[model samples]
Target: MTEFTLIPASGAAVPAEPFTGRHLIDGLWKDSADGATFDRVSPSHGVLVSRSAKGGEAEVLAAIAAARRAFDAGDWSFSSGKSRSEILNRVADLIDRDRERIARIEVLESGKPIAQARGEIEGAADIWRYAAALARMAHGDSHNNLGPDMLGLVLKEPIGVAAIITPWNFPFLIVSQKLPFALAAGCTAVVKPSEMTPSTTVILFELLEEAGLPAGVANLVLGYGDPVGAVMTTHPDVDMVSFTGSTGVGKRIVAAASGTLKKVSLELGGKNPQVIFPDADLDAAADAIAFGIYFNAGECCNSGSRIIVHEDVAEALTDRIAVLSRKVPFGDPLSDATQVGAIISDEHLGKIDGYVREAQAAGAKVVIGGGVLAVPGLDGRFYAPTVVAGVTPDMAIAREEVFGPVLSVLTFKTEDEAIELANNAAYGLSAGVWSLDVHTCLNFARKVRAGTVWTNTWMDGFAELPFGGVKESGLGRELGRFGIEEYLELKTVQMRVARGRNNWVAG
Candidate 1:
């Protein structure tokens, strides 16, 4: 038995009554037609956090119809760029004003550290501000050099309505990444956040209403994926679908949308890697590796779950990370001192531990903590930060996404071997290299198949750059200029200034 130090629960006040959430169809908030609702128990505190109207086929249809009607009405779709930009900026200001309220709900429902949740809210606000900037700057092309008698014009228009489905791991942040951009493109939308964490999104809708968004321009449904998300994906009225979740679900969305042939954009799972070379700054690399795996309790889609290190320094680096892993606080999410919080659920905690146990059974060695963590005075489920050494490229722990604070270490003797090992996974979301040699860094960055590659850093992101994945990781990109384009359609207009076209009909 391994006895671990746990941070005690903080004195932060829990609400006397759970939050009540409902479906936002058109511009009105209403309960489910059948009056069925679901409750969310805080994963960290074991207290009732929220009770939401469980949406079914009827709610889904109603929301979709609202978005379709709004788009067709052209009230928002045909609005000037300046108008859309102003609304988005106002929404951003509201997000900042309600930052504490949203962050607290996120911390309670998602079981993430309070500080981290606050940071995510801040990041979401920044994304909204960036999307506001994009609204006014969006433009099409024009050509006057076709000929003296002819002119050409290209125009970008909104893609009717979009269905946005987000996951539980990053409820507010992920929706912020998608919805504001869709709105900025002059598109109406129906959004569905995960049932486990729907209150933050509910708060966002309140902000949207306060911002004076046109009625039915954006609607929200609260529930599971089957009736809510399935209808959204296959609905003929929807012009596009943007989802962030697992790869299996991503594939299902693609298949469901095939019948209607609606555009589908996904940001899916990852088994991201961080490769270390002998010439790297070992101390800096060690600190980053520790942060990468432990951050978010390794539940991030871009989590660096595995490391491929050169043979000469593999042992030393692994030891360093193991020591740091033990030092990361794992306890109550309400505590500002806790770095790693409770697992989202007992089932997910089991899944994480199962992966590490299987790897150890197959010849991998546990370098540090390897089992459940008991936080003082709390009943929430937690897993200790684990590092598994002697992992081979063929091991399941090395190839699959454990989505936990578990790190797998594998050694490579040559650069080609490192690249081969890094590319062996079914995912290509992100990869990182930590070498001081500029040539070495450049070579790896060029050769890696990931959507985002870091030379000496891990998980540095900005609103100006596009983010997504390749292969099974996902399809299309989000953020940057490309984000809004996903919700837009292009049209070309050809004109004849000479007042007549060529006599193609022989008239």
Candidate 2:
């Protein structure tokens, strides 16, 4: 087995924090109606980071009213696309300027590796830039030859009062994915970020406000999901809802939105597959698999949790994966040498531990690092990079989303069986295939039932690509042009070219 050195955490100097708690509503920061507050905890040390206003029904309603007023008053929708694009570009620049600070906050609040947080910060900034460039390109179409004396055209206009709800994982990046596009499409928005990690979102709103967006164009509310999230989804003033989270909660959001027939776009959960063929580059395959499942402690919605390898090469691949998993250093996120940071909370840690225990009880072999690791001098939620072999498809860990640093290895007989096992799950969000053979790669890519397929790689994403799922994974799309289209409505206009107008009844 080849040993690889972990990249030391970057000790980059971060800027002095300029923004804190307080929600951004109507271009200003304020407390909730009842003055209730929630503590922001540092998942790295399990300490209180700060306190933010705990928004509830009254706060959510205020945000909705502000958004509705902004849309109906035509402050944002009346602006030209070029104007919107310019403001978005400015916001992107501001994000870049504060990237280091934002990355630090992300690392501190979410307990992700500093390196991964930096990448997420960069990705979020790029999404803003991409959405900015797309702002001026929301063009409508003109239809010719509708009739000899009639001219027709189709127009795309902004959907009013968008409600954006993002998950705790990739806090800033996921919110950026939807918020920038919503603003670019000339829609007013109320953002509800997960309470687990709201610091980055609060910083983002400060940057948005600094970008000089019109008053009431963007609002922020922080609270628990059930009350605040439900209010946002069910509010009549909210025209559309864009959410990213677990599939179980997504169904509830759908049910709530159905009452008013509100537009909805959900990016839900996944039990993604990483298939390794016999001809794959063993070293790269093992490394990719390790990073795919262990990165951010496998909190990603598109985490490659299931490993479907060809039976001939399954033993070799499993051995290599186990070796790699051992090398994944689990420690404080602030340490530059830490590769795997702590899980979000103790509840999530217990959930992941339960999955491992259940899988072991079901006769799966615990190959390496299958439980919690108590590091000296580190008091936080931590889980070791776990690998389970001899896992059957019927095992709970093999079928459900463990959402932790846990990987289940299953074998397949052939390419057809690999695709079958990969697509057998209820999720169709993301999948990865590793093969040196071009034909095998193409076949797997074409046959896989996932929104994003990586050939010879894993978890490589950009803001320019559209991402979502089929089946139970999600509805609609995020990022790229598709993201912008989600916040728009289409309308058809027709005009007659008669020289003299005459009433049909009079004639």
Candidate 3:
């Protein structure tokens, strides 16, 4: 394991302005046009951390213009892939070099456990490196079958300016996943990170600049999704829009992008399922399920919110999960021992609580936790890891995305019924199968409607494998060759060899 430097928070007071209150546009930090700013409160202590520039139409327009100029001038696009890859590698190194500081900022801003935050920082850096490798590896092909003198070739070109809108949850990770690939593909980008957790992204923009990305090649706008997000999606100059957020907002973005006919890639919300079988290891399965739903405070788009277990094992699995959920610590995000941290904000916390209340009112059993946890000496948006059994497939708690540390449990007797239950929702982002049989694993992998299915594992991902969803979950892919291709456009060139082809016309 790589030893990471830990920053001590023993100082009496943190800096008044821990982060710069400006938008990163054209490779420079600038304030919002209207001088508008929003306070970013820490979810851990409910205190104001920093005020960030609230970008609106004017700032959005400036970012789009800058990105368009960069792409139209072929500044980044004309550069060699090796050169681009080198710059991206430098970005990864910078992140790794400053991992501790970045992790602290993420924990403070996003209310994730310090350990998890550090891991996220490491993962973000890895994504940059992976994208850097893909930059040099992005190649086209040639095929010949017509005639000796005839030839056909295909080339993948940059898709011009890309508008990268990332969600508050996993801000750094989502940005790393999209921006690096866009830059690697020689495309300029205008980034709009969620205002709630804009600090890490601000740091990322600075790092990208430090890596020597040219002016106008990358930009960041911090603001609400309505105006800033709307502008980015509808911008005439932005040739592509890549977004990761809720399905509702994703639909709006797609609708907005239709006006300009821009390419769109969406990684939307999910109500993913984690199914356990009677023949599986119940102890390991319970631990994995606990982590899957409670990790990142259950704010992940692909969190296993739904647990579908075989009827023979449902009771044992639920009991084990409930017991484990109680053991998982939930407290201050800065605590090293804390496994579950606070939700993004009070509003989200209230929403999650509402779901639990409704489920109980609807006569469901709250086997473990189902209420807010008010920790002493600390005021944070913390919710205990909740497990609600006796949930039906059509219940609101089971169908809707609560986006918190809440789990809905259901039972199935047969493989066909399990598949039907898992595929019941509109989402098809990811699923998990816990079975010892090879045939069972292969069968579930083929039958599950999700984009990624894990056998004996849940929410585990790598850069080598593609990640995305089917059906209402979203479109386009992230990671792997498919992810790199999202930023490229294929062009085919052909040549005719027959000099005597005009004989028919002459006749």
Candidate 4:
């Protein structure tokens, strides 16, 4: 094991008491029917963060019933788009006003850098504003080409009661990705945030109430996947399920939701790649590559965990990325100076280390940082920013989602070979290409199997662009106009304007 620089916790104040989180049902906040509760200790700070109601079948059932009633009664589903848009915009404003507070809670709960959490809060607010605009711009198509006797209309309507299950990695941002869009589509929802981080969602619910969102429009249940998430997926009343998590768990959600045959939209795992060419700007590519792998401590679905580089620049590019990786701050997340923070848990830290060790045992060379990090005055778990070289396509570290600040480097000779190497994984959520030539960038983008392809950039996302995956990466899309469509259903209406419809019977 290597000893790296230790970062001590900032002397910032901790909450005197842990936050109290309860279920929000029918515009009321209450405890679980059985008085069950759970607690979250900060993964970075080693202190209690929150205590939340543990929702079981009874609580989940209540939330589903509330959403179903809210949808069936048309209180929100039939409301004017302008009304919904106004409320969404107000929520956006509220989010911006409380961005710092929300960011602090997220940092404490998720063990991510404070700066990154703050940026996510800002981005989440922007998504809310975008969803608000989407609400008003939503529309139906009218077919005027039909004969004068007949008119056809295609209407987009809310899918009704939706069950939204968000993961813990990017809690606030992920929920913002799903909930606002579902509401913008005029659907009521039962939401279950990961039990590990539930306070921020509770805060968002407060903002929703303050924004004048009607009762039973959006409900929250805090608990584990079993009982809570399981019921949300299979319930007879749930019209749709939008989930963001591991592909394995995503498969389970699909199978469970199949019982009801409800609509399912998933944003799952990724073993994303960034391909570097000989003609690429080495300096720029190296910088982006380092950021891609270390951002979110590489606990992101879009983490650029593996790099496929042309043989000509393989050694030089690998050295540059290795040098850059060491410079990325890995320490206490509370300090603004820290770039990478603690792993989510001791178990997760072990899982990340296991992948690296297995790769090393299989003949992979670690260029730098191949062990645990010791941050002063903190007992929380943290892994070093590792760079493994000589990684083969068949190696697990190169093909699997390591979900840590670990980078794997592999080499290729030709463009086709690079594309083949990039597309070799079972997951294809995203990929990036680095090249100055227009033809190479376009050709590689066209050949790649990922849902989102970046040219000369890695993980530059926007609210206007659609995001999702193909194959085992999971199904459907989120964000942009297509995102709102996930919560909607289409209906065709044909009318006979001229006296009466043509009759088959003898007149």
TM-score of each: 0.99, 0.95, 0.96, 0.98
**What lDDT is obtained when candidate 4 is compared to the true structure?**
0.92
How well is each residue in 266-323 modelled by candidate 2, as lDDT tens digits? 9999999999988889889999999999988899888889899988998988899888
RMSD of 4: 1.2
Give the range where candidate 2 is weakest over 10 consecutive residues by summed lDDT: 1-10
Tens-digit per-residue lDDT, 1-507, candidate 3: 111111222222334665666798887789988899998878876667878888989898999999999999986898999999999999999999999888887888888888999998999899999999999999888888867777888999999999999998998999998999999899999998888888889888889889899999998889998799888888789999999999998999889999999999999989999888889999999999989998998999888999999999899999998888877877767778777777898899999999999989888999887887776556677787889999988789999899999999999999999988988998999999999998998898999999999999888889888999998889999998788899999999987765644455653
Q: How big is the positional error of residue 507 in model 2, measured in Å on the Cα after superposition? A: 3.8
The lDDT of each candidate is 0.93, 0.87, 0.87, 0.92
* Cα error, candidate 3, residue 438 (Å): 1.2
Q: Any idea what lDDT model 3 has?
A: 0.87
lDDT of 4 by residue, 1-507 (tens): 233445687777778899999999999999999999999999888999999999999999999999999999997998888999999999999999999999889988989989999999999999999999999988889997899888899999999999999988999999999999999999999999998889999999999999999999999999999989999999899999999999999999999999999999999999999999999999999999989999998999999999999999999998898778767778888788988888888888999999999999999999988888877778677888889999998899988899998999999999999999999999999999999999999999999999999999889989999999998898888999998999989999998888966689977
> Which candidate number maximizes lDDT?
1
Supply candidate 4's per-residue lDDT for 176. 98
Query: Which TM-score value belongs to model 2?
Result: 0.95
List, in order, the clash count of every candidate structure.
Answer: 0, 1, 0, 0
Compared to the true structure, candidate 4 yields what TM-score?
0.98
